[model samples]
Target: MTETPSTMQMVSFAAWRDGALHSGRQADRRYVTLAELLVRLGSFGLGLSWKARLFDRQPHPAFAQMVKASAGSGIPTLELLATDAPYRQAVDGDFEGYAGSELALTLREFDSSCWEVRTADAWVLSEIQRHYPDARPMTSDEWDTTT
Candidate 1:
C-alpha cells in the first residue's frame, strides 16, 4: 500500500457534479492505503449515529463546530490527528470530518488524470455521480478559491 499523503502534499481534486466543481479537502487524508481508507470509512456510518444524541448542539455553530467542540471536550469526533496525537482517541480524532469521505479520496488522487475530469469516473466516481451530476468539471486554474 502507498503511504498516506502528507497534509502538505494534498491538493483539491476538482470535478464537476450537481452543477459546480465540488472541490475541497477530502474528509479523510491520514489513512495510508485503500483498505485503510475503507476501514475508516466504515466508521463513517457509526459516526453519523452520534448526532441523534446531541440536542443542545447549539453554542457549537455548524456540524463541524460541534465536532471540534466534542473533540476538544473529551470524546472523539472525526478521528482527525494532531500532526501530533496527544489530543485524540476512539473516533480517529479529526477536528471535524471535512467534506465527504469520497472527497477526501479524490483530493488525495488529485494527480490522477481520471480524477481531473468532467466525466463521472472520478477518484470518487460514485459520489461525483451522485452529488454532482451536472457540475462543470474544473482545472486547478478554474478551482482557485481561497476557501
Candidate 2:
C-alpha cells in the first residue's frame, strides 16, 4: 500500500564540505525521499534474478532539469534525519526478493572525489558523525522549511 503523506517519513539533512557546513541552497530542491530520489535518478539493471531489480530504469524528466540547475559547490557529507519507520518497497512473485530496509542512499561526485550520505538510521548518522566531526544536525525549523 502507498503511504499517506502524514504516514510517510520526511527526511532532511545538512551537508558539509571543505571542513564547514556548506550552504545548502539547493537542498530544498535536491533532497527527497529515497523512493522519489530513486525514481528521479533511475538505475541500471543488474543481471540478478530478484524482482526488485530496476532493469535499466529510465530517470524522470525532472532529473535532467535538476542536473542543469545543480551548479554549485559539492557537499561531501550529508546526514539525514527521519523520526518515523523506514520506507520499504514491497515486491511480488515467488522469488520474493530481498526484504530489507533501505537504510541509506549516497550520491557521489562525478570525479569520485566526494559523496553525500542520506539516511534515516540513527546508527548510520552516528557513524557519519564519527568520521566528520564538523557535521551538524539540521534544526527542526530547517527541516520544517526544507521538507
lDDT of each: 0.29, 0.28
- Give the count of colliding residue pairs in each prediction: 15, 0
Model 2 Cα shift for residue 85 (angstroms): 28
Over 1-147, each residue of candidate 1 has an lDDT whose tens digit, in order, gives: 112333212223332112333477444323132122323344442242111112232422333443444442232323322212222112111222222222132222222121222222234344533443443445445433321
Model 2 steric clash pairs? none
Tens digits of per-residue lDDT, candidate 2, 1-147, equal 122333222222333234334586443323223333223322210111111112113434333223233223211111111211012221110111111222133322111122233334355455555654654554435434421
* Per-model TM-score versus the true fold: 0.26, 0.27
